[model samples]
Target: MPDIKCSVTECEYNSDVKCGAPMIQVDHNNVPKSNNSDQTKCDTFRAKG
Candidate 1:
């Protein structure tokens, strides 16, 4: 499995700066061919609250 680094402390799937989920999806379809990280989002993100 690839190592996925995450910094969203509020996400339930985040643990020790890593993703604990079995899988993750990067949704950049809204901004195709974009090189900006801000333009993309983690669809698997789930708020802990």
Candidate 2:
């Protein structure tokens, strides 16, 4: 756990302001290489049921 901070309340892995997933998978969206946070997204995010 890298102590990831999360704010996507709709995600199941979000506990408070921290991520509770065993691990986080983040990758660039569309762009071949991301140069900023806005270009990346969390692949570990699962919608809360």
| Candidate closest to the true structure, highest TM-score | 2
How high is the lDDT of residue 44 in model 2?
A: 88
lDDT of 2 at 33: 95
Question: What tens-digit string does per-residue lDDT give for candidate 1 at 1-49?
Answer: 5888899979999999999999988888588776888878999999996
Clashing pairs in 1: none
Whole-model lDDT values for every prediction: 0.88, 0.89
Could you tell me the lDDT of residue 34 within candidate 1? 65
What are the runs in model 1 whose C-alpha is more than 4 Å off? 29-33
Q: Which candidate tops lDDT?
A: 2
| Candidate 1 overall lDDT versus native | 0.88
lDDT of 2: 0.89
Q: Model 2 misses residue 5 by how many Å? A: 1.0
Name the runs in model 2 displaced over 4 angstroms: none
lDDT per residue, candidate 2, 1-37, as tens digits?
A: 6688788979998888899999788899889999998
